[model samples]
Target: MDLMDLSHQNRINTQLSKQKVGKTIYTDCIRAENIKQIVPAITQCIECYPRFHRAENPDICIMVTGIPNVGKSSLINALRRMHLRKGKASRVGGEPGITRSVLSKIQVSENPLIYLLDTPGVLSPRIENVETGMKLALCGTILDHLVGEDIIADYLLYTLNNYPQHRYVQHYELEGPCDNIETLLKEIAKKLRKTQKVTAITGTGKFSEYPDGFLFH
Candidate 1:
């Protein structure tokens, strides 16, 4: 199918580009647009599956699962919009833990008789390493407070430098690429004017208030 061919060529992840897997379909879609493209591919997958093909009208119940904040709910909502011409049945959020529990099935397509189950995001019990966990945390799979934004931001800087992606330097209007997160944060806060006055403890039990730059409002 054209959908499968397009998906196979869409290499979003460099690490997995060479790896081959059977009975799996890859699709890259934006929720606001290209959502209609997903439904046909899904229908094709269901039709190709021998277990579901046995029944003429199979009650196709697809359970969507992935790490938190990877757009599982958003995907369901997009599919619903594309297939059934409906609005959002599943709620979406920027952070993790948006979908609290498994809710009722949402019918996305009528022709293939398909229904989708949106479930809470689950993490693997065994993560490969600290760097892997940090990457997940950076992607917002885990809560920011648990991993700490400072750590994640530092790791991000490291990854960007390692990959040699210097677009941030131009975007931030920096003189050159930065190796220090603190310096970058100060420049960003200065550029965006995201600063707050906070009192600090000084020597000899004295206190002084100074302007502090913060990313969060």
Candidate 2:
């Protein structure tokens, strides 16, 4: 499907033509326009999905890192449906870091060679604040590049809480009830639906009405 088709399918309303922008070749254009609207966000995405270092022959690795149960697996599954491999990345569950020792890599294309890495949830880091900052920066960057700025920020808030002590929360001053991760996931789902232009308050209620195809195109 083209970009427009995907957006229509996902209910994302944007001016960019789906057919023209769907191709990976137009990613730079999307990034340029998006960065103009949200600078820090685009910068973050670039850092997260860094370009191949060696120009002669570079291997691109796109890392998908987020807190547990934040739909990371679901997103990967969706991507896999788009022809990407679902490497043996960690599975989603209440416990963090299920794929502790293994790194799941999905090969998107072979000619240029793109590898998408699903990393372990960022909870208690073996390192310190610096590592957390770097991860948060990369996460923000990736989200902004692919999704949007506000969505990325919201995701960051939801995921960073996975590591209660992560300095990103303090840096952003995100203060709220310390609800469970499930609550945050629901919130993300609700926001995602809204981003797709669905106007439903109770996310569960909307989800329950899936039979009517209320949200799906």
Candidate 3:
């Protein structure tokens, strides 16, 4: 399952009703680690067959494309495992833009003479909207510092509240559904023991704040 579902299924339906989004033609979410489904998924997107039956080309080149951190590299590696019984040929990581160059094409199968061409993840220079950009940042498709963790975390809380996704409330051991993001983050920072000290001026006079330096508190 996705750490965060970017598909926005229900939101997409709403967009479709407003004629803001096109009708979905095809979609499938497969585990990158699942070798069983990888080959079929690859074949569905490209033609793979016995090399002898195919034309003059020495190998069939299959190009993989998607936004940053969308598992393009892992899919190539998984395909290799499923058909070629081999290990990873491309580097993969949680950060965005992990594959930022032309990676060496990997041979996923000998019988079919298939090769996977991995390319750098690219995004349009212009983002359509603020919300879309925030969603991208929340999904780690953009670097955290670029968008700011505080802003991203707040957006996540806003979205969760709008959707009334309370799993996070209980997960963070909050008393209940809280509307304030700062309060929520305070609780999280407390749970994680990530408090830092700060100085503040008060009626009592200038003093160190929270003693424990409770950030977001």
At residue 53, candidate 2 shows an lDDT of 44
Candidates in order have lDDT scores of 0.78, 0.45, 0.75
Give per-residue CA lDDT, model 1, range 79-189, as digits (tens). 777778889999999899999999999998887778899999999999999999998998889999998988899999999999899999899888999899998888888
- After superposition, the stretches of candidate 1 with alpha carbons farther than 4 Å from their true spots are 1-25, 31-34, 44-58, 200-217
Per-prediction TM-score to the true structure, in the order listed: 0.77, 0.30, 0.73
Which of 2 and 3 is ahead in TM-score?
3
Clashes of each: 0, 5, 1
- Superposed by TM-score, candidate 1 places the C-alpha of residue 81 at a distance from the truth, in angstroms, of 0.7
For candidate 1, the lDDT comes to 0.78
lDDT of 2 at 196: 37
Clash pairs, model 3 backbone: 196-213
Q: Tens digits of per-residue lDDT for model 3 on 1-217?
A: 3554667767867877798533332222344444555455555544434543455665667777878987788777877777777888898998997888887778988765778899888889999999999989988899999999889988988898898788987787878887777878778888877777677888878675665465543
